[model samples]
Target: MQQTEEHHSYARATWQVVEPYHGAVYFSPEAHARYEELGADNRAGYFASRGAALGPASAELVIGTFYNFNPDLVHRALPAAWQAASPQRFLAARLAGIDATLHRVLGPEIGSAEMLRAAELAQQAARTALRHPQGRPLFAAHAALPWPDEPHLVLWHAQSLLREFRGDGHVAALLAAGLDGIEALVTHAATGAIAAEALRTSRGWSPEQWTQAVQRLCERGWLEQGPDLALTPYGRERRQAIERTTDELADLPYAVLGQASCAELRRLARPFSLALARELLPWAVDRLAAVAD
Candidate 1:
């Protein structure tokens, strides 16, 4: 226990030096209390992407993604806020509203009771968040931490959990590849084919590390060694699945969520979807800027 404590002490110092914003959020009294009640094991209210937080920007995006990612949790955590117009909600309600609206505007017409309400709330939030002058700095601060080299930690984690829950081996394998960085390379190639050798040098991967990534994809038959090789039919399908999700998220922007007042726009979800798309594209750009090795 003494040794473990020492390691955490060291980690805290290192984290603060490199990622100070995290220190502020993690040490917040309310955040610690919330995590304690939620429990470390189940990790409710805790984020897979950025862990727990309190500030509005982090709260809105991270908390919003939580509910947006898992519809079932909507009722469990913020039922009153999303389900009805009563006074009871937080970051999750506003985010969920955005997610539901984006989906409706893009796909599917079979709306759930909660979904219809979600659409309404998104528009109200997006417009208000965008219009507020003072809301700019506060909204920008909600931004995520620097993404790792593979920009797929949360995406891969959520997909992996979903596969485990539904027992989907095919996708489980694909998500595994994503986390390991093998999948992202091939996907990036099919889209535009970034020069792998140059990318490796810039990312500072060892020759072996780069080779192994290629080898992993090769073993799965998604890639092969050749003068001008490319992905297979099976590989395209898996990559397509990932691209589709990104395409969906690309439709919403964070700024709209930042300054928007959920109370004022309890029913304007549809128009909000377009505004959100613009926000999401820029947000993704920001995260990719800090991707780690």
Candidate 2:
């Protein structure tokens, strides 16, 4: 296997392997139910639970940190979400939900020795991320939270910190590239990784707004002027550059882990991540399979 110390590839690989395990908290039915009991609907639950780490942050703060969702959508969820549940309550519910979900999805493996080892390595990486909070708001906010005791929960929390660390960097890269939220989604859609309509709907963008963003991309010569949203060659290169920058910014924690430990963490985490993806995020299965290769 290629070592993480070789270059940026290790950082990206680590992210891909662990993402499903960390991200499963969002899609878990147990999490949704907990939020629902607090009087937060799905949208409110999603924004509030994720943003609760920021300590009742405003809609604008969420929009800035989230960096790709519609402002109006964020506005609809905030303050109201806080009113339904305090940040502390939201955070507690989030942890409880994660506990229940992991137990359900991972079963006996949650307490396995391999899990303890993965948690140790992941927490080490997260500590490295903690040292470099500098401009990473979401990551810093999460880093302030107390660490959980269970191996599975520790692994989840550490990966959450690392994911947000990368996410904060990704947002910085997007801003540096001069791509606004809608424009970023437009170009992402043009790459055909996901359907354009799905991206628009998930981000709470209107059809007209989606069309306008497409027009803006076309004006920038980043997209073809046809019915389909296809990237021009230049557009592809620009997109690749943005990803490269994100990877560069995200490499620090893995770099601290060194090649052997990074490889070990990936090896230890892969099966658990794959299990979570199979249970909670079917779309990620093929991508995780490719990484396993």
What is the per-residue lDDT of model 2 for residues 59-97, given as tens digits with 9 covering 90 to 100? 999999999999999999998998888999999999999
User: Which numbered prediction scores highest in TM-score against the true structure?
Assistant: 2
Residues 42-81, candidate 1: write the lDDT tens digits: 2233342132122422334443332212233322333222
Q: What TM-score do all the candidates reach, one by one?
A: 0.30, 0.96
Per-prediction CA RMSD (Å): 20.2, 2.1
TM-score, model 1 to reference: 0.30
Q: Residue 115 of candidate 1: its Cα lDDT?
A: 38
User: Candidate 2: deviation at residue 255, Å?
Assistant: 1.1
Candidate 2 residue spans exceeding 4 A from truth: 1-5
Query: What residue pairs clash in candidate 2, if any at all?
Result: none
The 10-residue segment of model 1 with minimum total lDDT is 14-23
